[model samples]
Target: MSDVRESEGLTLLGNQGTSYPTDYDPGVLETFQNNHLDRDYMVTFRCPEFTTLCPITGQPDFATLYINYIPHIRMVESKSLKLYLFSFRNHGDFHEDVTNVIVNDLAKLMEPKYLEVRGLFYPRGGISIYPFANWAHPDFGYAELARTRMFEQLSDLDRGDGTR
Candidate 1:
């Protein structure tokens, strides 16, 4: 993969002795040119090991983050993304804030045609909080798609089995 010209921006892909960050740093994120610019397709990442500190209680909060995006010209590198997410380990923020911040940072990094981030936090104080945020380019017809997907996610969480 290193021989490919498109992989030039990747710095952490196959490197040994990787170091995880101890605080929130958006600079850890990296991206490469999108190879499939002619097609509009979704790329999804499931980060099940996401963790951070709660702002109010300073307690550790755990979540599975679902990131979906439609690339424009650049795509995020996965190893860099792992390190970037790890940077939030010691950072403190509310559930909603964390979700929004991630989406905002990723949007700025890739400038995707459409993007959405959903954080499914573990239960705390007998309640679980799931925050979802999405963005779409005004010229694209994706704004309606974003709204529809949001409703679908909400419906999925309301299965009445209390499993969300």
Candidate 2:
């Protein structure tokens, strides 16, 4: 992959001794040209080890982050994304805010045709918080897709089965 132009923007992928950031830093994200721009497909990332601090109590909040996006011209580099996500480890924010921030940052970075961020936070005070956010390029017809996915998420929550 070294000779591939798409791999040019990657920096943290194979590096050793990575230092997780102590603050929220969206600049840690990196992107590469999407090789399959002619095709429309979904890329999903399931991160089960996500953690951030609660805004009020400063206690650690654990969650599994589910990210889905349809690439346009660029796609995020995985290792750089991992670093960017980890940068929130010590950052303080509500679960809903964290989900929105992630989706917004990725949208700014890649300008994907569509993107969604869902955070499934662990139960606290006998209740669990699930935050879901999504965006789509206005020029494309992806707004409908985003809406559909949002509806599906809400429907899933209504089921109260908690399987997903």
Candidate 3:
């Protein structure tokens, strides 16, 4: 039911011949204009099968990646996002670094009002690592919100609570 104009700049959505990348490729992320400029709403993506390699060991690392954002004028297309994340399967990086990299890439692509990436990595060698990163547009009055939310998330650990 969507018009062609509504799907401009989107190439990976319905293409049946799309190929998956074997490396980290942020260039594959595509976006389209946001229709709701008059309101602020949350957009969230949960990728439960995210996989990458450890930078040092080259062993596989698995994670559930959470991406949350408030769009400004453009929004990432879902199929492209899936491909972009899939591109990390063979990439090597620490969980922290990988989480930050994804956030940075999406932030640059959309320039959203606010964006955050959270990676809940499965235990490797008896240790689980959770990496979180976020950004807020300086002039958009969301900087404080970013700080506060980050604090709240981190503070749960300080209180001996495992919830995040």
Candidate 4:
């Protein structure tokens, strides 16, 4: 979750059918230029169905990724984001790790005033886990937490998204 989702250099990354982030950027750039998210007030991208393989088990994990943030100077190009998210196709890691990684990467590149990522992974065995990650400055308080609660409420919704 980036406080400021709008940015100039915020474009997509990676290639498709592979773990490359390049292929996903160009298209997203067109959207950025066309839609002008770089100047928008708030933005939310809900990647409902995402998948990736487990590093050791070679098993697949399913989760839905919700990226919410506000734009500052630049906005993330949609294509690059698609590619970047696609880059995890063959990646191996736990729900928590991946969630944190995406947050950190975006934080470094975009430096949004607020950023949050909610990873709602499907059930494995008899239980399901929802991995949540967020970043906020000491100045801004309470809002992010409440938002997290709202996102976490997904457990109450049957028509939710998942990724692997």
Q: How many clashes show up per model?
A: 0, 0, 0, 54
lDDT of 2 by residue, 80-110 (tens): 8898899989999999999999999999999
Query: Whole-model Cα lDDT per candidate?
Result: 0.88, 0.88, 0.88, 0.63
Model 4: per-residue Cα lDDT over 20-113, one tens digit each:
5422122222223334544535568888677766778969888788887665544566666766777677778788888888888776666555
Reference-based lDDT, residue 37, model 2: 74
Q: Cα deviation of 104 in candidate 4 (Å)?
A: 0.3
**TM-score to true structure, per model:** 0.92, 0.92, 0.91, 0.65
Residue 27 local lDDT, model 2: 89
Candidate 4 residue-wise lDDT at 3 = 23
Count backbone clashes in candidate 1: 0
Where does the lowest 10-residue lDDT sum fall in candidate 3?
A: 155-164
Model 4 CA deviation exceeding 4 Å by range: 1-40, 137-164
lDDT of 3 by residue, 31-124 (tens): 9889999999999898999999999999999988889899999999999999999999999998989999998999999999999887878888
**Candidate 2 positional error at 71, Å:** 0.3
Name every residue pair that clashes in candidate 1.
none
lDDT of 4 at 24: 19
Off by over 4 Å in 2: 5-7, 158-164
- For candidate 4, the TM-score is 0.65
